[model samples]
Target: MRVTILGSGTNLHPRRAAAGYLVKTDNLFLMDFGPRTLSNLLKTSADRHQIQYLLFTHYHADHFSDFITFFFDAVCHSKFVSPRADLRIIGPKGTKALFGTILRTFPSFNDSEFRVTLKEVSTRSFSIGSTRVTPVPVTHTDRQTCLGYRITFQGRTLAYSGDATYAPNLIRLCRDVDLAILDCSFPKNRPGEAHMHAGECGRVAQEAGVKRLVLSHFYPIADRFDVKKHAAQVFRGKIIRARDCMTLSV
Candidate 1:
């Protein structure tokens, strides 16, 4: 499996774009279509028209605004150029209703040349082609439900934490995975809410036995400090500081 960090920073960042990660194996899977992420994805060799699944973690604007442009391209451009297979949008509960609202809000997105399916999942395992996906609830915001995905394709497994805090479920979800793409929204001891810091990320990586720890979703303040150094204090494994368009083979 190959994982691409399309956008590693948050909305507050200047140099880095918001959350977006693409995982490609037998199929193409995307998580978090934040602002400017599509522009970064276009830099890669992968074809956007061939993306099979659109997996979301939550509905925060920083993590979802680009979906409008992505869907628009699929509807208008890719339809006649390089028509692909059905687009499967998988998210937590309320996904169907939320997307229905989007479709209704935009008349241009009304009729798609191809089929678009919305599937909601929480604490449940589902399959997309040969890939087995497990969606687990993670602590992000109290008012809205958030999800983290654990996907297994072929013999490799990886987990992605969308935006989360330190929680036991998050650790359990990442246990023994080959790669753990965690939310390192801040540096060590940085005052923040609803996201994990670098030190906490290290502890999670060590405890979960994650072979590779990918610290992403950075806010601008994190750039002032060594995030990998902080995470390495607890985790002895490979720690990667994510950069836009950085692709890693898992």
Candidate 2:
């Protein structure tokens, strides 16, 4: 299994990062479609049409804003085509509603000939193609129902902590996974409502016994947070501070 960090910035863009990831096993799958997702994937020579599944972690604009572009390209652009025979989108309870909103929001792109399937997932394990996906609710903003996911394929597991603080369920969901892609949104000293700090991630990583810990979702202020120095104090595993387009083989 290969995992690529399409975008690792926080809510802010250009200066900070937006959330996006690409997981592929011959068949491409995308995790969060934040701003500039398609553009970033293009930078890696990945075709948008090759994406067989779109798994959303939450409904936050920073996490799902670029979905509009994907929908538009799927409908209007004939150059891109899905190799997996179908495009399956899996998200939280409001996934169907959100998918409809995106299509309705763009009238010009509504005249598509392709069919897009939207599946609303809950805190349960399900399958998308050959991949086994498990969604675990996380504590993010109160306005939306947020979730993180543990995906398993061919005996390898990848746990992604979408956007959450230190939640016990997240720890359990990620336990013993091959790779843990966690949300290190802020630094140690800087606290936020719905994001995790590097220190917090370290503690979770140690408890979960994750084989590798990849910290992402960096903010502009992250440079001043000394995440590497602080996170090292807690986690004794392989730690990587993710950058845009960083790829990992698991």
Candidate 3:
């Protein structure tokens, strides 16, 4: 599978966009849809209608605001945009309610024209076609279950830590995965409480024994320092600094 980094930075970063990723298997899977990511998503190699699943980590505005536009274009405006398939919105426990609320707020969206299914996942393994998905709980907030997803397809495993602190669960989620897309919101010295710093990303990758590590969700301050170098201090594996529109075959 090929995974595209639609948006690699945090919300409101001057040069980078918030969280958004596209994993293309037999079908398309969107990891997160943050502000300014819709345009990037449209620029991908695949068309919009091919997207069959939307996997979200949490409901942070930076991570979810673009869904409104995505829904409108997919369901209402582009109703005749080729032969569209049913879209599944997957997230934490409150996934269904969030979409229901959006439907309520925007009565104009043609919900009947297209079938949008909401599936709320927990810290358990589930399946979509032949793909295996595991939503692992991470430390981020108390209001909800902050998830980092581990998706296995055709024997290849990829994990994404939406927005999380350095914790044991995160290590488990990324353990032995081919790639670990983690939150490196801040540089090592400049740590973030709610997110992992670049050093922590390396430490986690090293402990988890991941083959490769992608330090993403960067803040502007992180750009001032060498993030890759910082992460390399602990992790000896292949470390990639995520950039917009960068695609990797995993």
Best by lDDT: 1
In angstroms, give how far residue 117 of model 2 lies from its true place: 1.2
Q: Model 2: what TM-score?
A: 0.93
Write model 2 residue lDDT over 117-188, tens digit each, in one string: 889887879876688889998877788787899989999999998998897888987899999999888889
TM per model?
Answer: 0.97, 0.93, 0.96
Q: After superposition, how far is residue 205 of candidate 1 from its true place, in Å?
A: 0.6
Model 2 misplaced stretches (Cα beyond 4 Å): 79-85
Candidate 1 deviant stretches above 4 angstroms: 78-82
Best model number under TM-score: 1
Candidate 1 lDDT: 0.91
lDDT of 3 at 165: 93
Sort all candidates by TM-score, best to worst: 1, 3, 2
lDDT of each: 0.91, 0.83, 0.88
lDDT by residue (tens digit), candidate 3, 1-250 = 7899989887899888799999976668899999888888878777877788999999998898998888877765445645467888999988878888887778666454667788888787988778888999899977867789998989999999999998899999999999999999999999867888899999999999999999999999999999999999999999999999999988
Superposition-based RMSD of candidate 2 using all C-alpha atoms, in angstroms: 2.0
